[model samples]
Target: MYENLDDAELLRAALDAMNREHNADAVSLLKILVDRNPVHPYGHYLLAAEHMQLGMVDRAEEGFARAVALAPDFPIARFQLGQLYLVKGDGALAKSTLAPLADLPSGTALASYAKGLIAMVDDDVSGAVEALQTGLACEQEILPLAGDMQRLLANLMAPTEDGAFPAGVETTMSAAPLYLSAYGKTDP
Candidate 1:
């Protein structure tokens, strides 16, 4: 746990461990950090992330909640909490939690994607397209959502009800090529 280190060093070590996927070591260090400095919002957030990586949803949610309580203006914590609500299928809660992301987050791309997902879940097709397009324009690196948005847009724009994409639809991607990997599980 690097007991000899100060708070900042401990946090760095915890984050380093987390980035390396050593969640157990990160959790141990973060537990000590939060224990020593209960008011440390980032400490709580890091702890929450480690907990999430360990598949401990309740603890992760609790830690995230604590971080929010400690620092209400932290957009990342709010975004994460909203994602958690969405994953839990609490659409109303997720919407309310994510309402601020339309303007407040450091980058709005993820927020827009989330908004698009919420709109799609709510059957607001036009709203979904608007949000997805806005998000893609803001950051092309957000390509994981492109496939979903493309499918949805195709459905909405299809002349027929056959569930097929329109002919001559732009096949070229403006975003970088994407890997076939799962998202919305860890970072969304």
Candidate 2:
């Protein structure tokens, strides 16, 4: 029962709370926004993200579905929905959801990242390695994901004789490869 705030104001407050990691407050603001504009796709998107942060996957799924239903062309929400599907072990659904995004300029990196994760989850080691490598090449800002992706790739590309990791794979010289590439190496 919010009194006078408009959708933009509520959205602003939600973003502020989300930035502060105040997920509960973000959810409250998003709820008010949704109440005010149930058909607004972004409201549902914010709610879904907050719910995901809170580990309420079922509710998050519902909100994400609502967002997609309201605006099927919304790339970011669809990408996040695909990620949720991946987390739920629904590889087929995740791939299907993420596939269309690959064609959009804004969605290219996200689609690649999701596909890479899907490949990893399916134990398609070589495929994951390739996808992750391409993802990194396409979007270096995905460096945060690069560490785990590199670890996974290293394990996949490891020699199968004794199942030991291949050389230069076990240890990383940088957690932020993009930053390292930009600034010329990191401390560790």
Candidate 3:
């Protein structure tokens, strides 16, 4: 039923399905889109995001990597890919994947998020919290991503079993998975 649709139409349908939480349908449509237009970075990104929502980490990682490879300037794809790596406990790879985002303006959401993630990797909980707060302040486009940052910040700030705030990366890493299922729905 979707074969006849153009790339734009297919993306629209996929987005609609995602909006309605019909991930299977969205994945089907996005797969067709990427199949028809193999170099479309957005298609791969969306497909990867749906994969993430469904907990298909490997496929999501591959799709996000493909999207970033195809469009190096696509900050959202790069950020999400790095985030996936961080959640998977690959700090080095995550830092590398998120490195390019540093070129973005310091006040931008992606830049701040990248800084936060990198700080988390470096075990700087205070720095991560500061950067995430900055990101949240300027983040209006991708609400879901902001929500993820907020959750991470909350986790970092929360006291441990001994009533002391987490002093290392453990809390951040532990809370990372909770935000994985919350993919950004905005078109990048």
Candidate 4:
């Protein structure tokens, strides 16, 4: 069915399949592409992600390693590789890969997110909430993801004492519900 599609289109189809929870189908499609183009970093990356979603950690790690080998500087692949290591409880490797990303301005929010994941793994709930919230603040374009994260953090870090709002923060928060309503989505 994907014979006429270009590589990027094939990748999009695989992502759509993954989003719809058809992980086996996504893997099959990605495997076809990877078999034909072994060095295609995106093919490896997509397969790696599918394997990760399916909880096949060993296969996921192998696929991610191949992606990194094929495209050493591919930021998304590197980020996911770090995440795989984090999931495997390989803190040393995760830190080694993710720490350098923090110094790059474009990678700042992602690096912060990785830190939050690490904190959660370490059972430091407060640190996770703080780090993820900071990351969400720094990357407002990630509204859907950040909104869910903000709700989770708010619940986790509910204030114990009454506090004054920063100048426009309350106004911004109050307006958010209106904006979300206008967009026909519930705030998470």
If scored against the real structure, what TM-score would every candidate get?
0.69, 0.71, 0.88, 0.64
Show pairs that collide, candidate 3.
Answer: none
Query: Please, what are the lDDT tens digits per residue for candidate 3 over residues 98-135?
Result: 99996798779879989999988887778888988899
CA error at residue 13 for candidate 1, angstroms:
0.3
Q: What is the lDDT of residue 61 in candidate 4?
A: 79
Q: Scored by Cα lDDT, where does model 3 land?
A: 0.82
Per the 3 Å backbone cut-off, how many clashing residue pairs does candidate 1 have? 0
lDDT tens digits, residues 83-145, model 2? 667667687887788777765664355556666656655656566667766765665543444
Best by TM-score: 3
| Runs of candidate 4 exceeding 4 Å displacement | 1-6, 115-130, 140-188
User: What lDDT does each candidate get?
Assistant: 0.64, 0.64, 0.82, 0.62
Give the per-residue lDDT of model 4 (tens digit) for 24-101.
888888898898789888788778767766667788778878988898776556656775576456867876766655
Which 10 consecutive residues of model 2 have the lowest summed lDDT? 179-188
What CA RMSD would candidate 1 show?
Answer: 7.3
Measured over all alpha carbons after superposition, the RMSD of each candidate to the real structure, in angstroms, is 7.3, 8.2, 2.8, 9.8
**TM-score-based ranking, best first?**
3, 2, 1, 4
Q: Write candidate 1's Cα lDDT for 52-162 as tens digits.
A: 766677887798789888987776677676666655667788787777776645356767766775675575656767886777667544354556456545555556455
Pick the winner on TM-score between candidates 1 and 4: 1
